[model samples]
Target: MTKRFMTTGLSRRSVLAAALGGIAVPALATRPATAALAVGTAESYVPIAVGAGGGPAGSDRVHVLKVGPDTAHTVLVLVPGMFGAANDFRLLARDLVAQVPGVQVWAFDRREESLADRTGFTTTDPAAYYLDGHYRSLDPATSAFAGHWGLARTLCDLRAVVLAAAGGGRRRVVLGGHSWGATTAMAYAAWDFDGSPGYDQLSALVLMDGGVRGAFAGNGEPVEDSPEQVRERLAAIDGGAVFDLSLSAVGLGSRAESTQIWYQLAGWYAHRDPDGPSVLQPRMPDALRPPVPVTNAALLGVLVDSGFGWPNDISVHSGHLAVSGDVRGWVDTGITPISRVATAYAGGPEPAVWEWYWPARLSVDLDVADAYTDTDLTRSLGLRLFHSGGLDVPLFVFQTSYAQGTIESAAREVVASSRIPYAAYETDNGMNHLDPLFAAPERNTLTTSLPSFITGLR
Candidate 1:
């Protein structure tokens, strides 16, 4: 297997070669020398138990994809967004570890990832399994317990991972998140752990294109849910809303088509047949599917590219899917590479990162908890938040170009309200919500800036 690098204490020729080669010249020029170590790829996959959790097997453990060495002095612990998994951070983690040597990046997978239908991965005909609906998925009712895996549990679970990384405070830990994962980071900062606060465990916070909404962190859109609405929302799982929508888009589902299958189909096909005619495009809506017959790579780019006008803020500028010639091609926007996106979205083996069992209860909990603020209704609903004011960790917020800017605005308000110090803030108008995570290493803000950010804090 190809070895992955992370910051460790060992000295290696490749590390020096990589640095001398100026792979990340801009970042390495300023980063600490000790932060440049790396370990083998085999040591990265880690899973920690959640004790006796209420959810299904998915909630039994939290998967962590570690880059660098455990002996590193600094750690970057990342949380995945909605329906995201540990593998989602692979490219970003690899990039970050390469630039800054001594920092270990612990990218996490939600308990929900355990529910993904990995069976499809064993098949060579992925399209038959994922696209042609030749598969069987777990019964929704069997996953009912997942509805109880709310924010409180998520935070508590994250706390366990942080404590492990901290090793009794020997390592300085930084928490980062993308999309709803950003919300998770902020919530972790504001979370109350027994008497100690969650921020006490973190040196800094990193947010990418996400913010907490509702009465607490909403930039302008405050949640106006009445107590009754909150109650109804709390009962969502009971009403049979247990999983997030899968396939091309939300609201379209057949029993055989799980989100895992869709992701694997798109990602795998794009990787294997990037220049071939799209297989999934014909099934997608007119707005999302390429107007003309396009290549698989182009098809994947359109799913998140701004050119397609994917209204849900999932849009990014990875360049147009079709570059030239008669058919579509990948036009790199000098941001994210389509190959990297394919790797992230594609699922192959047992530990591949793709979340299929997203608990509707967590979404409910985030909304009802209302930005980590404790209220009478929230408390009555069994949430343990209401501690946003206690968060005082340094903040580093990154907002993509095409977003509404609400995430940054909301983070700013939180920084001000909680008196959190602003370590850094930037807006890359060149990127989209997902671009921040998948940007090319040489030009990525995550790789170029985060190492120094974490090291400086230490």
Candidate 2:
């Protein structure tokens, strides 16, 4: 079995040769290059050097899915949700090109350095960042970089990506995001970079299943986690050593089996024991196994076996949760199901264990002292955007009747206050947070309206 180890210090040739030579390799080897899809689109991953924000600064990759020719077209820059990979938008990006005709979609892959599995010190250091079931802080002050990963750096990185993608000059750019990505999008929209409006670079904003403020207390209304609550959710991710953050938060069903499947697909864990046959062997069908030992980069077969007793035919084995059903109850509910998947499939990806340590550090770094002094009306999109003077850009918010409360009221206020035309589309199609991006094009409710809404932009 091929062992995926997260180590540094060797020459690039040594590492690559070891990986090719079937020796111990870093987690980077597990990341498979995305194959170009058949949807008449070209996919290119561009790396942008991001200056330090909250931690050791490095380059972040942006995945561009360009449809038609490479000439100028409306660009929709999408940021993935927390810990989100750009590949999550693969299907949606291709579909948008077909539906909208000229618009190209670029999805950002945020900081992945922590995936090194070592303390954030010199790359050569071998101390595991995660020790004793808790992720240790690796911030410069704490461990390596000046700041850890903070929302400030996140916003800055996104801005840099926008400028770079625009080829320097301003163009019609619609900044969009999903879930936490939507939160970042809203934060980006509100930030006044260089003492000017942050939304200046954005022509419009498209938020899906996130950026809702009504759910928070200091965020204008009292939801569950009040501003006084001190966002422990992200912190919990930092302190907690187990990497079982709910994928259900992003609309995946909350089934332990499915979560295992998702993590396995990410190469977060090993499917095989180092000595014996794969621990996942008995659970998987013979047809699904690759000819060689199942490498982390192997195509993860969607769990389609009904014999496995999984409700949905989707590749993962989430219990009864439908991929498109109401999954909000599971978001932040904190009730993680016991993983029913076998032990081998349940191992943690070495890099993920280390990466979780810094996400909280980044959050803490972005948390400014005076931020609370500025209300959402003037400084941010708190639970909603009010009629602010500078928010003249077009905005489109898509929501389901069940999940529309987060931004509808605020979106209306912004539209009524400004001359900018906006649209809030709602449906009762039982879409969860993930449906808009991952659902099949025809099965997805929000995607159908995208063509008209985008083309309608003046």
Winning model by TM-score = 1
lDDT of each: 0.65, 0.44
TM-score of each: 0.82, 0.58
Candidate 1 on 238-351: residue-level lDDT in tens?
877666443324222444235455555677788888888888867764433444567788777755554444433444456564334566666665466677788777754545
The clash number for model 2 is: 13
Candidate 2: residue 330 Cα off by (Å): 23
Segments of candidate 1 deviating more than 4 angstroms = 1-43, 57-59, 132-134, 213-225, 246-260, 279-292, 321-327, 350-353, 419-422
Which 10-residue window of candidate 1 scores lowest in summed lDDT?
1-10
C-alpha RMSD of each candidate structure in angstroms: 10.3, 14.0
lDDT per residue (tens digit) for residues 35-79 in model 2: 223364775655667664433334343223333334546788887
